[model samples]
Target chain A: MKGMSIIVKKVAQLISGLIFLYGIYIITHGHLTPGGGFAGGAIIAGAYILNILAFGSDAMNLKNKEQGSSLSESLAIFIVLMLAVFALFIGSKIFFANYLPKGQLGEIISAGAIPLYNIFIGIEVAAAIITIFLALVIFKEEVKK
Target chain B: MNSLIPLFVIVPLATSFLIMILGKFINGFQKTITPLVLLFLTVLSFYCLLNNHSNSYTYAIGGWEPIDNIPIAIYFVMDGFSLILLCIISLIGFLASVYSISYIAKFTSENNFYSLLCLMITGMSGVVLSGDLFNLFVFLEISVISSYALVAFGTEKEELEASFKYQVLGGIASFIILFAIGLIYWRTKTLNIADISALFHSHETSTFDLFIQILLISGFGLKAAMMPFHAWLPDAHSSAPSPISAMLSGVLIKAVGIYVIIRLFFTMFIVSEEISLLITTLGTISMVIGVLLAIGQWDIKRLLAYHSISQMGYVVLSIGIGLVLLARGVKPTVATLAIAGGLFHMVNHAVFKGLLFLNAGAIEHRINTRNLKEMGGLSKHMPVTSGTSFIASMAISGIPPFNGFFSKLIIIIAAVQAKFYLVAFLAVFVSVITLASFLKFQRYAFYNKSEHRSTSKIKEVPFPMLFSMIVMGILCLAFSLLAFPGIREQILGPAIDVLTNPNQYVQTIIGI
Candidate 1:
């Protein structure tokens, strides 16, 4: 559970932030680009994993964070479900009909509700992966104990 | 009514996550909410079933309209076939959840159990109602993945090992199914089932078309636990906790397995003689072989698990007989009878088999043993468990006045009329063997004079558990009335109509 070498730790601290930013960028631009919720979410998880690997899970308070992440994951998915159900009541009353007014085609907000879906899904996926990573690490640490 | 179709998938999925999040703060929330949601679902499904005027309904997700007569939207269709499936899913699900209120108390993380059960129900409902192929595959994964986790819920060595085996086999099955879907998509350029059917009907089926059928049958057959691909059933079913065992045995295999096989063959693909015979042959082999294997099992759940395979064989066999007759364009009445028997037996099996598993759970709850040799004269101790199991056993063995007897009689009559003397004989033979097997189950578990266990501390299960078992036992007898023509036409009639006339299904979904 100890941290890695000073060099590796410093390098991860420097690069993980950049990776986190990149993941957010990917998630935000998901509607216009190739990477959406899943790919960007994996990237965000990678950044957290990198930090955990360098600083050690004990330093990261990952065991406690696992609970919060899972709860967040549940909440994100619930929001997604609510969004779908919300659409069931609007306008013509379709389950997943996009209710938001469409913006211009090339804009970030162009696709209306699609971007909102991607963001929530991204959050859910990132939280899910982080929770899974934290769980396996905690299990390993506990088993060692 | 049509707007409610997606809610079958939606309500369960939403409640599952709600349990996961809300169970953190709310005391006794999982227990109360789980049964309430299931009860609501059961009532909703019944309302849908009875209110329908022999018509099918479809809902397109996202309000996407078909373009140029091609359905591009993800569709949920509630035809007669899926309606029957929906009723049974919600019914057994309600009962199992009620049973879990008591049964799952012994386990830690009660929230996780309920949440996963809800998720599994969501998946099965989605599979039943999905009109498109890819969504069906997605929902199948949702249910089975939850099942793998649920089977290993106890995390005991044996339970974990069984779940692992199931996952490996299930992963392979999913891959085969996905590959088949990909091929179908490549050929028809559509994911809508009705669309694919219309396209396949337009073109004479080629050898490549038959290959996709093989892939689908083998993939779903693995899920169904037909003879060749049944290695996972006994271990998985036995190792899981009893209520889960009931759900897995009673409804999971039917929803994701036999139901899909029947739906796809009848509506998605054109009926082929070779494939029909193949299905019948597989069903018969599973019937005889599954029972042969069950007789030797010492574990109560394992024995019931094997019987599940055998009984499922009855369903598949009768349906396959109908398929064969339909392929030959012969006696429509015999085909209808065979299919009616299959559907009736399927519903009956859900009730009796579910009751049987609950009984096993109750027995295991008390004595901490599933071995027959380790049990004796439990009829005096656990009256409800013993009494209900008696009803289930008699029903399964085709004794008269039980639902099983009527269904088996219809299947045998259909086989006889179709001139399949050997099939009729095997149907009779399998029923006799089933009788012997259950008699062994009865003698050792309930009626044996020998005192194997101390038997001093045993008592009846809690009211919630017994309540579920009693209702299922009542259903076992109540369903026998379905054998009468008047009652039969009301329940099994629509499901039989859908299977017999695939063109109607295609036209309805495509709105041609």
Candidate 2:
């Protein structure tokens, strides 16, 4: 059982990583495309769920999951907020404007502030979803046991 | 200031998940950790509120800018109104967490309870802070989905039934709201509220516009538990845990229903005379019928739940009167007063009604029953519960020196000034009946000498629960200070301004 679980864990981890990378792609291209932070983050969380299932109830530590996800989520949201404040400080009136120099459109680094905001949202959503499921997994085991 | 916007949603969202994870690894961890985290977030949010005086802060997704005066990205805006509502959400959330410390001890899964609680708060916070309409819908879904699950947490027959009913109504509301969003997007090809408002301002009137308005009213009205859409409130509010009930009754409906309605109608869309009159009619009908229903209830929570509908009716009626005056271009100051009264009453309800629910929870906690007939002479064994309930009861009944009285006074004064004599009379009449009904509660549940006293032994609830009740009772008194001079201008004035002149909100957020 342990050997099979390890094999399953390795495969799931590989798949989850691929999905996470895909989420990053989606978030970065959010402005020019259909997908953004929420959709990508949900996908990333799906990866975390898969990993936990493979490893069983004790696979992930709830405390670490909670601490890590909250910090990341807070940081991501804060980053987006700080950017808006920066615009105010610099003489821009409205929030979420493109503060950066607009590069050539359709490039990997284009859309100015759009890519950056997507990155932050992607991080927050992914972490929040993971924390939610991990908390549920851990709590259910404790209740059952 | 803009940098702080995401923290409003992120802090609670992350903390809730964290508590769930911690609960999995450690025994009894959630009971302590969840409340502590919530308290920390509440303090942080209050700090933010104090610093955020009169500026509207907006956060854009991916830092996207409009290419040709067209918004192509999601944005979040927080102004005086959203900030005030945010403070209320955090304040009530913190107290509910504190109350839950002991209240949830009887429940089987502390972790799940905390998780749903956090999710609900996250959704509410997100809704308040969201700048885009679609984003609001997403957060709205987050909050409602968790709330549906929370309502049925007990898994009893009635609970499941209530959850099912709530979900059906909730789903329909969501469907209508989505279709409204689709219509607005279909017309303007934009989902941003400011952009939509700007679009509608330049465009000619159409039937599609009216259709969208009706759809939104129904959608948010159902969530707000307005009279016509209030079928699910009595069951949904009474069936949840006390703290959760406090949340649903005190904060959830306001955030999702009335708050959204106010934000959309006042800020995002124009309020026509027809719409304003419709709102007044809904408010008056709900006020009379909700109280009439409550007078006959034996279930303690159900009675409070029905009152939630009636009290909310007071809020809608007051605000609707303000809207009617605004539409007619009549005495602007008196209309502003009416709006302020309604908004003040919203805040007061959060405090006193929330306290009343917690008090009911304490009674139910000690005796294991919510049937008013099954409870008698509780004051002898639980002085703190009895005292606090008396304070909350007095406050809700509009007695002097409590927060509820000032708001009700303002509403009555506003009603009379506007020449709505019948409304003024009915408002006063309802206040009296509310007093009588609460007196019934005090007589039967707390003070009346009864047979249960001789046979069964009861005691004051554990410290955490009592501590929450006492704090809420104190707020019921302290918040009345808003009726005084400085605080009203500093806090309430800005909120009233945001609603009265919706253009100021768009300009401020767009950095005019």
Report the lDDT of model 1 for residue A12.
98
lDDT of 2 by residue, B1-512 (tens): 77667767766776675665566678877777767767776787667667766556777755566666666667778877787788888889889988998888777878888888988999999999888899999999999999999999888999999999999999999999999999998998888888888878778758788889889989999999999899999999999988999999999999999999888887777668898888888898889889999999999999999999999999999998999999889999999999999999999999989999999998888788999887888888899999999999998889999899999999999999999899889988898999999999999998777765462578789988988899999999999999987888777887888888878776654543
Candidate 2 chain A least-lDDT 10 residues: A88-97
TM-score, chain A only, candidate 2, equals 0.85
In candidate 1 the C-alpha lDDT for residue A69 amounts to: 95
Q: Tell me the TM-score for chain B of model 1.
A: 0.99
Note the residue pairs that clash in candidate 1.
Answer: none
Q: Over the stretch B1-512, how does candidate 1's per-residue lDDT look in tens digits?
A: 99889889999999999999999999999999989999999999989988878468989899988888888899999988899999999999999999999888988999999999999999999999999999999999999999999999999999999999999999999999999999999998999999999999999999999999999999999999999999999999999989899999999999999999999999989879999999999999999999999999889999999999999999999999999999999999999989998999999999999999999999999889988998998999998889999999999999988999999999999999988899899999999999999999999999886466578777888999999999999999999998999978877888888898898888887883
Query: In candidate 1, which residue ranges exceed 4 Å CA deviation?
Result: none
Report lDDT (Cα) of residue A50, candidate 2.
78
lDDT measured at residue B232 in model 2 versus the true structure, 0 to 100: 99
Best lDDT goes to which candidate?
A: 1
